[model samples]
Target: MFAFVMRRLAVAIPTLLLLIVFSFILMHLAPGGPFSLERELPPQVLANLNAKYGLDDPLWLQIWNYLTGIVLHFDFGPSFVYPDRSVNDLIAAGFPVTLTYGTLRARFKTR
Candidate 1:
């Protein structure tokens, strides 16, 4: 049983790394953090906000930091669009919703 689990883990490691790389690229490309859309913050304040989040870090360091953050602390950092929730929690909710897709929708659909 341990061997089987280990074998799958071996395969999954690379897949997870790929996902991290893709996620880092996509998140960095977006305009700003969850607070970015706030009308209250002035332009200069927004620039400071980005820097505080390490948005200006080199791509490799950013990706490495992101990957390590999850493995070491089980965090994917905060939500870029929902400051109140962690990225890990948001991602966790999405999987079951997506996995059960039509079954969930069909139950509430009217004829």
Candidate 2:
């Protein structure tokens, strides 16, 4: 059973890495960026925003940095939509509500 679990994990780890890389590539390939708006921002402001988020880096470098951050620190980085909060913060904030709903559903289902 241990060996079976190890074998499954070996396959699953690479599969998950591929999934993350592909998703990152696909998101970068899409047209408009997070800073895109109906009213055009000045070039200096746009450049500053890109620099702040490391968006000015090459795609490969960005991917390397992101992967390293996740692997080394287990961080999902910041939230693009909510600049003041991080991805982890958003998840943490919503987790309690999710847990409450799940617990209630499971309790009711078993009755």
Best by TM-score, which number? Answer: 2
If scored against the real structure, what TM-score would every candidate get? 0.62, 0.86
The regions of model 2 sitting more than 4 angstroms off are: 102-111
lDDT assessment of candidate 2: 0.92
Deviation (Å) of 105 in candidate 1: 13
lDDT of each: 0.80, 0.92
Give the 10-residue window scoring lowest on summed lDDT in candidate 1.
31-40
Expressed as tens digits, the lDDT of each residue in 1-93 for candidate 2 is: 999999999999899889999999999999988888577888999999999999999999999999988888888898988999999899899
Candidate 1 error regions (>4 Å): 29-41, 89-111
- lDDT value, residue 97 of candidate 1: 76
* Residue lDDT tens for model 1, 5-60: 99999999889889878876887688755564656688787778778777667888
lDDT of 1: 0.80
